[model samples]
Target: MKKLNCLIGAIIKDQNWAVIPFGNTILEPDDQVIIVTIPENASKIREMLEGGPVRTNHIMEE
Candidate 1:
C-alpha cells in the first residue's frame, strides 16, 4: 500500500471471524482486505497491490 490515507475495512478470515486491521497488520491466507482511496491515486494503489512497477513522482510545471 502507498503512503496515502487508506481506510482498511474489517478482514474476514473465516466464517463468523472478522476483525479490524491496522497499517502494520499482517495479512494471512483467506483474509479479505478492503480498501478505499482517492481517484487520483487509484491507479497507483492498484499497481502497488498488484506488485507492478509504479511510476515515480515527478513535477511538471507548465
Candidate 2:
C-alpha cells in the first residue's frame, strides 16, 4: 500500500468493510477500497486488481 502511493501518487483514502490500511494491508476478495487519484491512474489500478498483478508498483494487486 505504501508502494502504491510512493510509486504512483494514488492514495487509498478509505475502505469499506476493511481495516484501516497500513503498509502491509492486504485487500480481501470483497473489500471496497476508496481511493483518491487521477482518472488515468484509477483505471490502471482497477484493471490491475481486476485483471491480475502487474510488474509496475503503479498497479498493485491484493
Candidate with best TM-score? 1
Worst 10 residues of 1 by lDDT: 53-62
All candidates: TM-score:
0.41, 0.34
lDDT of 1 by residue, 3-60 (tens): 3234344555555545545454554444455554456656654555564222323212
Report the Cα lDDT for residue 4, model 1: 27
lDDT of each: 0.45, 0.40
lDDT of 2 by residue, 4-57 (tens): 331222223243233334343444443345554456566655654554332223
Superposed by TM-score, candidate 2 places the C-alpha of residue 20 at a distance from the truth, in angstroms, of 6.1
Q: Total clashes, candidate 2?
A: 0
Clash count, candidate 1: 0
In terms of lDDT, the poorest run of 10 residues in model 2 is 1-10
Superposition error at 60 for model 2 (Å): 18
lDDT of model number 2: 0.40
Residue 53 alpha-carbon offset, candidate 1, angstroms: 18
lDDT for residue 56 in candidate 2, whole number 0-100: 28
